[model samples]
Target: MPGYHSFTANIIYNLAQLGIPIRDSEFFDIQTYLEIVEIHKNVYAGETPSRQATQADIDTFLG
Candidate 1:
């Protein structure tokens, strides 16, 4: 089964597709992680497993 790191890998991969470069360390940093979680919640809404993020979501997070 896919675990936490795999999940985070998915996040990183998707973000990179949007030209939003992110470091592995940033995912563990409280501030950056919280921002990512917030943007994630907003993007996925009620989706349980959290879908792969889109460029629009990344743009929103960038703003």
Candidate 2:
């Protein structure tokens, strides 16, 4: 867990870049953290389909 905070910060930064807002409290929540990780995985993937799917997911999550 040495680089855990750094890793989560990177994920939060990426999400912010994508217009997703994350609260400081949510950072330590296992479910929310996992959800963010899953979203980040798809959004940052090299495949077009994955990106497209993640975009839809982001839209839904935000709405």
Query: Each model's TM-score, in the order given?
Result: 0.32, 0.35
lDDT of 1 by residue, 1-63 (tens): 659899878777766654466755454665775586678658776667857999999999999
**Winner by TM-score:** 2
The residue ranges of model 1 lying beyond 4 angstroms of the native Cα positions read 23-63
Q: 42 in model 1: Cα distance from truth in Å?
A: 15
Scanning candidate 1 in windows of ten residues, the lowest lDDT window is 18-27
Computed on alpha carbons, the lDDT of every model, listed in order, comes to 0.70, 0.71
- Mark the regions of model 2 whose C-alpha exceeds 4 Å error after superposition: 23-63
Candidate 1 residue 58 Cα shift, in angstroms, is: 34
